[model samples]
Structures are given as structure tokens and as C-alpha cells.
Target: MGVVPTDNELTGTVRSLRTSNSGLGIPKLLATLLSSQPEWSVSEKRLRKVIQRLKSEEETNFHPTSSLNSALDVSKYSNKLKPILFGPEKGKGLVATQDIDAGEVLWREDPFVYAPPWEIYEAQMAGTASWQDETRSNLTKGKGTSNKLGDESPLSKDAIWDTYRSFATLRNDQRWSHTSENDLARSQLENTFRRLHTVLINALYLQHSESQEDVTFDSTNTGSIPAPSRSAAHTKQLKRLLRVPIPEATLNSLFSWDGLMEGLGKMSLNLEAHGGLFPLHSHLNHACRPNVSIRHISPDGSTNSILHSPNPSRITVIAASLIPAGVELVVSYVDPSLDLRSRRRELRAWDFGICQCGRCLEEENSNSNTEHPEISGNRTKIEGGDERDVGQLEDELRGFLSV
Candidate 1:
């Protein structure tokens, strides 16, 4: 038998219905609400929590995200690189699952995903399914408190824990904001995010002090710039950073953190930090002894988002020097702008172990006074440098040295 609706349920359902009218929310459009399917089989507990959210939302009279809603068409998205080997740690490293040859486009993806309307995330915050119960339970018991639930505690002294939504502050995967789905009768995100947390979230969440809502950026692909969104209290700080990277500037405001040491212990989520065309030059992973290398080729007139290749149409990975198959593949993470030490530091920060690829080892063994004739004046760094220049020069040799 169907369960009878409580007063809260009846009132909440009607209120929820009204907030979603075509004029307010996209989902409320007549064609959508009347013909939608039931939500997927989330647990009953999570479902009731959603009901509670409806009641809360109904009471708050929260306005829809009209600004974000009307901008991009909710449907259209590009499938550039459908990401393969995701990072084993906190959204950092990804590897090729299959053997990829030189010059092949290894992987490409839009990398940006649309997030659920702020309403859904807020509901999850208030103890709805996906995140609410999980966050409260985890926080009260203090297990995953690394996500940092300082003032926001559990709904009651006794509550069941759920992990789904708790990860918003815990993980750093850019993909969490993915807006892949165009239409759905039921919520399209719960399952996708659960899977995403697997690929990205870390257990040791580090805390920062930024307001998540105030951060915004322009789409490099679409060229759409947005003014930063911030609470009233942050107006001064935002003004100070008007021209600085809007994203990095807000990192300090992040109120949570990830604790797991990425790439050191367990595998974490690997993600694309920036989206652009990475020529074959971006593919190499160098070892102390290097085998492969990368070089950014800027054709006559290409924008920062696009690059031109020397060989007209196609780009390929090559043995900058003779590379044996058994050696690890390596690339210089920096563009041509980086010096040796700079290159090394960048790789170390990203958690790659010291490169000991074949080429790096060979240079050390040879110990030549001068570089190999083939390498002199070569724009690309075929192999990591040898130890010959390390201790003696120390600080002077910053880029690829001792990193």
C-alpha cells in the first residue's frame, strides 16, 4: 500500500512544485515536470532527506540561479577527450591504458562538467541524500572530518552517515562541476558524482578559508568571462585581486582540505587542470634519466588555447633521442619558458617520482664536458639532466636540478 503523506510532505511537495515553474527553473518547464521519470533507486533514507530539503527550500523562498541558468544552453557539450586512466590520487595523474604510438592524439576531453543547480548542492548541505546524511554522520563521529565541518554538525545526536555529498569540499576534481546531461526525469547527478568521488576525492582533506561561491572563471573555449561571485564580506579582497588569477586567489578561502599525500601512498584522482590542445610535446614523462621530451610549437598566429605544429597538420611523439622500449616515457611539464630547475620543481610538486629514464641515466654516465652535439641548441629537452651539474652549482641550477 502507498504510504500516506504527512502534513510536511504534502506542504513540501506543493511548494517544491511551485519553485520549479517554467518561469523559475528549467526543470519546472511543463514539458519536463509532467513527463519526468522517478528518481533512481537511492536509499529510502536519502529520499526522505530530499523531502526535508523540499520543505526547507519551500520555506526559504530561495530564488533560482537565473543568471547561470540563462547563459549557456543546458544541453550542448563537447566530447573531446573522454578521459581514460584517471589519477590514482587526488585528481593528478592519468596514464595510457593501451599502448599508444608516437604522433597519436593520446587523449582529449572538454574536462569541464556542469554542476547541479546550487539548489541541489545546498540541499545536500542541509542533510539531503548524496551528501547531507553522509557529511553529518561522518562529522559527528569525526571520521572524515578532514573535509572540515567546523560549525555545520549532524542533524541530531543520532543520525546515519552518508558519503555521497560530503565530498564537495573534500575532493578537488574539476570534473565534479561537469554539466554533461541535458535532460532527465530523475536527478542525473547522484550516481555520476559517486563515481567521480572514486576517481578524485582524497581522504586527508586539507582546509582552506575561501568562500566556494565567490570563485568564477572565463571559459577559455567559449571566451565567456564572469565577474567573481562573493559574499558581501569579501568585496575588499576581491577588489585587491581584480587582475590576478581569480581561481588561485580563492584557494586561501577554501574552508576544507584533502589530507592524503597524493601519488605517495595510494592512487588518487587524476584530472585535467586546464583544457587546451596539447601537442605531442605535452606527452613526455621524464625520469632522472629521460627518454622522451616535449616542445610547444607556436605557429605563425595561434591563440593561447591553440598551437600550430611544424609538420603542418599532424603532431606526433618522437624519440627526441634514441629511446629504448623498456624505459619510462617522460615529458617536460613546463613550456619552453622554463629553465632546468623550474622544470624539475614543477614535476616534483605534481608528485612524480624522480625520473630515471634511459636518457637521463646515459647523460650522467657519459659525463661529457659539453652536451651531445645533437642536443646542443635543441629547443626540446630530450632527457633529464645528469648529476654532474648538481651539487657544485646548487642554487644557481634551479630548474631541472636536484628536483
Candidate 2:
């Protein structure tokens, strides 16, 4: 051994190596460091100790708990409804604490995490400046484009991690239980991250290319436009960004993939549009003829204004009809106008299985009775036919009911 390297020197070397090559393994890092600094005589065991210490320091510095805790507050809405376990199959649901009148607001909540749909992500990757403006205009006119929930921007790694943390705290889903199944899930998550990473990199490259064109060309020039391509400078900038290390804990936990899936599962069950994961709103179970309706609202309580506003929207739960005390609050997961068979089919696709709501049960009983030929005939037509045929059958059924 020559001379032992100082702790500060060893720490700096390790940090530099990690910054240059984030995926470098410990053995390789040690060998590379020793080779570069032949004057230093550091043992492999000593270098390992320094590496662990640096990781611990980084983890401690990266706490987002304060912001997360502030955003998750539901104290204002706690008195209106309470979570109650119905059974293993239904899991936890919300019940009214007091009688709620029709049109009365029950609760308003912000999303724990928000991600735009694939279309929006593609637009961002393509560097389309007009996509957001068009989407906002459509939403204002009540001609909303997509049913999927999401915010204005493309999904970020930070948002993904936040979603994971929210799900980990909830611990309501059975999928959270760790087993051998996680290996497959982890692989899927890695693929998702890789795709997202590529999208972000490509978007950055395109943005830079556009800026370069603006600088190099004048408006008076009527020359043919050149195709976009990534420059060496853009690649260097992206490489620097990609080298930033992700927290070790986040990589190992559900946030990597399962947490994202859980968030999506909850979104499907709860939200209509304006993608977000509202914790309090999620407890309300599904019913065909539900007593409540959910909608997105701006901070000032304007329903339509949320579409174009830069501020995040909140989900407002309103009583559609009179809900008595001690009753469970529910909302329609799909269009309530759909016939029994159609409704059941939609719910089944959502993994809700057969709906056992009171209206559904009553309809099922009515269908079982041979006395209702019109109702049975309409159901058969809807099951076998397209939307136009179903609409025609519905009109015929309405005529019979009127008589």
C-alpha cells in the first residue's frame, strides 16, 4: 500500500464516477477510481463504506413528505362521509354521515398525481405547440376529446414516484402484497420507464432543433425547411440529465410499476375526466342509479373554467338526489342511460363483475318475469346489435312503457 486516500477525496471521486456513469457497478467503479488515481492506496472495503454513506446522505436529502402531507388533507370533507368496509369483495366504501340534499356538494379534492393520456404525450414528443390550445378549446365547448384523466403536461418521473408513494400509504389493494409475481411487474415497469425516458429525450432534442432553426434562419428567406435532427450539444445535455441517480428505495418498491397500475385502477373506478387520483372521492362505490354526481371544478367553483385555467382542478362530489343518513353514497361508473345488459357488460369490462346494486337487482327480477316481453325483447336486441339498433330498440321500449 502507498498512501491511504482521505475520506473527502474518496467521496468526491465516487460522486464524480456516479455522475459520469450512473449505471456503473461498485466493483467497476472501484477499479476505475484506483486506475485513475494510482497515487492513492484505498482498499475495496473502505471504498464500499464511503459509497454506502453517500447513498444514505442522498436518500435523507430527497424527502418529499412535507409537500405530500399538505396536499393529502381531507379534514374539511371528513364529516360528510366515512369509509366503511362492506366485505372482502367490495372492500372499503363511503357512507353518508348526515342527510344530503340534491345538488348539495359533498366533497372537493385535488388529485394525488396526474398523468396525461398517450395522445397528449405523443403531441408533446412531436413538439406541437397547438395541441394544448386545441384541447382546452374543445373542453370549454363541452366537446372534450378524451375520457382518460390527465393534466396538461406529459408524465414525469417525479409524478410517477408521487403516485407510488400515495398507493403505498393507502395499502387497500391486494396487489400490494409482495410475492414472486413482482418480478414480472418490475420488468414491465422498467420498460414503461424506458419508453417515457425516450419520449422526454426526443422532445428535448426537437425543442432544441426548433430553437436552432429560429436563430439560423430569417423570416424573409423562402427556402425549403430542413428536417429536424439531434445535435451533439443536445445529446450531451440529455446524457447529463439521464445520469442523475434515482433513489434506491423507489426502484425496489411498487412505484416502479405496480403503484402506477393501482393508480390507473382507482382512476377507472372513480374519475370521469380531468385525470387525477382523489383519495376521498375513490371510496364512493358504483351504482346504476347513483345518488351523487362527480365533476371537475376550478378554485372559484366554476365548472367550465377549469378547462383553460393553469391552476389544477378539484373534483367535486354533488348529491344528484336526496341521500338519507346512514345510506352508502354511490356514483355511476358508466352512462346511466344504458340498459341492464349493456350496463352489466360495461361494468364487467371494468373488472367490476356483475353489478348487485338495488336498481340492477330490481331490473334483473323484472326481466326474469315473462310478463315483460317488451323489456326482454329490447335486451335481446341490445345484446346482439350495434348502437343504432340499441337506440331504435330503446325508442320502441319507451313507446310500450308509455302505453
Candidate 1, superposed: residue stretches over 4 Å from native = 1-101, 112-260, 263-330, 335-353, 368-403
| Residue 254, candidate 2: C-alpha displacement in angstroms | 7.0
Query: What's the distance in Å from true for residue 127, model 2?
Result: 12
lDDT of 1 by residue, 11-82 (tens): 454455556652544324322423432332233444446556765865664221111123333123211211
lDDT per residue for candidate 2 within 1-403, as digits (tens), equals 6778788888998889888978888888888888889888887888889989989987664221111123434566757776777754465677888888899988766666664433444433333311233354244323454434364223332333334334333332344446678767765554554444443333333552254223221223223333445578877998999999877877755474444434444664544545666667766678999898888666676765444345444667889999889999888888889877767766765546678788887887776632332223332333446423343465457558862
TM-score winner: 2
What C-alpha lDDT does candidate 2 achieve relative to the native structure?
A: 0.61
Which 10 successive residues of model 2 have the least lDDT summed?
Answer: 62-71
- TM-score (all chains, Cα) for each model: 0.24, 0.44
Best by lDDT: 2
**Candidate 2 Cα misplacement greater than 4 A, ranges:** 1-73, 116-264, 269-271, 298-305, 310-312, 369-403
Note the Cα lDDT for every prediction shown. 0.36, 0.61
